[model samples]
Target: MVLTEYLSKEALEELVDSFSCAGAFELEILSPDGEVLARSPKVHSNKDSSINKEEDFIRFELPAEAEIFVGGEHVGTISLRGLWRTGQDSSSTSVGVKDSSNLALSAERQIAISPAAWVELMRDVVVRLCDLSKQVRSRVEELSAMDRMTNTFTEKKDLKEIYQLVAETMVKVTGTDACSIRVFNEERTELVIMAAYGLSAKYISKGPILLSESKIDREVVESRKCVYVADERTDERVLYKAQARREGLVSALCVPMIYRGQIEGVIHVYTRRPHQFDWFETSMIQGVASQAAWAIVNARLYHEALQAESIRRQLRLAGDVQRRMIPSQAPKIPGFEISTIYVPCFDLAGDFYDFIELPDGKIGICVADVVGKGVRASLLMSSTRSALRAHANYVRDLPALIKAVNFDLWRESEISDFVTLFYGVIDPTNKTLTYTNAGHEPALYIHEGKIRQLDVGGGVIGISEDAEFSQETITLSSNDVLIIFTDGLPEAINFEDEAFGRERVYAAALEAWGRGDSADGIGKHLLWEMRRFAGLQSRGDDLTLITIKLQ
Candidate 1:
């Protein structure tokens, strides 16, 4: 059988150089059938060419021969040629053959060694030396190569480059036909290839390797061990057997790359010919896989950190812009006092409030809560606030204006998006407040310590294109107070996760109003009461509130 597939030309050359004693020239590794599997191209030729022509060249001939075996099974033979100086005496000893004349110089032949004396001795030496250093010359060389690989791994910061380096090194060290690296996606549903070498891009793009479909990869991931497929074309465990056949990948060794006690990915080495990986090749790849796993983990962490920092910077800049959009101070209307508060748990908030000065001295007040958190919700809040302000003056009817705002929100939102809002106009001259609540936390109209929830309106905005809305108009009176807020106020959670329900909000509002406080005083007092009720626990959502009074 031809062992050409198993041989490494570089490793054989290195092995021959290590045993390059005096009178040794060429080394040939022949298969069981005497076909040359690998031969060192170091020093060789008959007396015909360069050796005789160049004075710097040494003379040599192929003569010594020995069998190479593993576990007492003869796999191949090593035939060595010996080096002889051109000026050596005729009686000087050779390695195995009788004619050093093939390498002889000046048309004279040097003596050869007795076949019986050194053939068996050189046979044991060549076989044992090759067996000991087939992969590497010594343990030190292995360690040196490993050290170099480790340094290379540590120096890498990009995941794709690291994977590519590891894949290329695997084929070089193991003498395999190809190598690929794949990592489990965040959901672990798919094995996505990060890098590959010695394989065509067409074969790699054959299909996604779904975990459920690839029994071999699933086994490697679940067991955290290497799996061998001697023949992928016929292996039932292989998900893409036909594709593997097209790729000419006959055998594969899948090694799990485990990081921090968890299997994160797999490293696969393939052979063009069917091959059972030996212990040395398996261990070498496993060692490289271990180092590569750590490098991959570090690269992922570094990339994620960069993304997080960029998001933080963006959110910080957005928060600054959002703060400018919100009314720094409530409009100061004649014969009326208004106050407002906005507290965001995160740098980016879903809640926003705006005051739009309308025609005929009617001031438009809006408090809206977009149905989400973070940057996305804040974006919706900005757009919704802008749309509502744009329609406030054009649509004098409260219900019609609410409908217009709802349509704008619906146009921009996905199915998961919507906004709860309270939009109202206060006419100081007419002493009337007209309002519409679009699925908002109802505004409380308080008179003489009684709380009336003004909650008449339609469903949430942005859910339906033709959502209907309703409105209410109330005649204002001296000492009458009105409060509007988002769900964050009443739904605030305590340390024990208990909500400060609507009743608590009413009680707090009444208690503050009973203090005979102005609108600003009452708003501040209500906020303090709610914070005290929450037991200083961090708020989970954006909190917003507004207080208005006719004094």
Candidate 2:
């Protein structure tokens, strides 16, 4: 503490007054430069007399003076003087001598206390007051330091910045020579230094420290306690005693940084002198460590939440784009009704469908399912759809269109990814459907209460560039329905692990047809039946279905 902070002029005057009353004499408080800061009243009527000149008081000056101290540094002195009277009172009647041999003499003096005793007494009182002031100053300093440290922890947002601030604040508050913050790795096998203050880079980068190898760090972390080591040069618990000695560190304290009852790291403070850590200092450092831990945990959690939100936004965008890729409504075909349904288990789908109008009143209908899910599958599906559309504009043959699309997918997509597709063209003039099935579930044809499977085509797309395909034409009479879908329909599982198999699909189609359901009605009924079978189970894959019913 600074001397002037607690030893103001008014305080000095009060001290001098109290001392004068005790010593029964006037006293003056002088600075180290001999300037008077405070003075007590004198017994004699000499108030107007100046005490600035040391010459006037030299005759009555005390031989002893008491020194005022602040934190062991002397700032000023206190002194006392004797006041004397040298004549008789005017009220006394004096008799004169009769002759030259006779004479009358009178003298009066105010008794003063012994200078040595007064000096000792005043010195003790001043020393005690100074000591009390020092204690008060130290307490105020500590409280202010803690307030700053707590604010630092609360205001900082980044974990690394908080760590550095904590280390620096710890060093400042405790008057430590250096400080280091070591946080445990995710595996909890080692302690990694996150921040350091007032330490040499060479000493900080000494080497890796494994928790198993460092007993002191391990004890502090596992036991969630603070550990202190005095005389690091001789303490066996010191992990880097050689480095500590080189860094001129003789004392150390390690406090655990814990959050939610789990220790996350340790805050290590080092001092240059071999000093023991008191209870107050240890408790204060521990409190700082606790706040640091809370800040670190909050920072980590906030970062994770931000990352999760970013992923969610990306998924939503992908879902929107994938949905837009699929046709929003089916096209109009004379004497025919078309209905489509798509259900993706995730944000992006592997299943897609397109209805392209061809030349001469013919319409191209395609349903394809990629082998996988997510963004990759969606990309492959998009590329395949573009290829099919481009090829269908020129290529009239269903088998040739399938072959072109297969070649493009095989050349452009990853070798592991493949697509199963059913491409069919309906010739309204001839009332015939020509199609090719590329390793997909066969389209079911229901006519006159009889169900038939249209299973013709080749291997799945993207498996081989040289894959061959075939096309077949089937006559469609009135009341005939064609059902095309991905394997997700038949492979959908129930709570009992029972699949809604080919037989069930055929039965559902037959029942819907018998009930005189339209294309949309039949598709909706099939979905309802599938959901009923699945019961609380999630769809294992992307689901797509298209139904074409002849009017």
lDDT of each: 0.79, 0.81
Give the clashing pairs for model 2.
none
lDDT of candidate 1 over 253-328, digit per residue (tens) = 9999988898888998999997988887788888889988888898889989999999899999999988899888
Q: Residue 267's C-alpha lDDT in candidate 2? A: 89
Tens-digit per-residue lDDT, 1-551, candidate 2: 33355667788788877665543345776777888888876543434333222222222422356777766787777776532222323232222112201211122223344554566677677777778877777767977988877776667678888888888888887778889999889999988999999999999999987999998998897778999998877789887889888989898999999999988898889989988988878887898888888888888887789888998799889889889988999998889999999888899889999989887779889999998888888899889999998999999977788888889988988899999999898999999999999999999999899999888999899989899999999999999999999999999999899999999999899899999999999999999999899998988898999999999
Estimated TM-score for each candidate: 0.72, 0.65
Quote the lDDT for 168 in model 2.
89
Quick one: best lDDT, which candidate? 2
Best by TM-score: 1
Worst 10 residues of 1 by lDDT: 51-60
Off by over 4 Å in 2: 1-155, 182-194, 200-250, 261-266, 356-362, 386-420, 434-442, 452-473, 487-508, 529-542
Candidate 1 achieves a global lDDT of 0.79
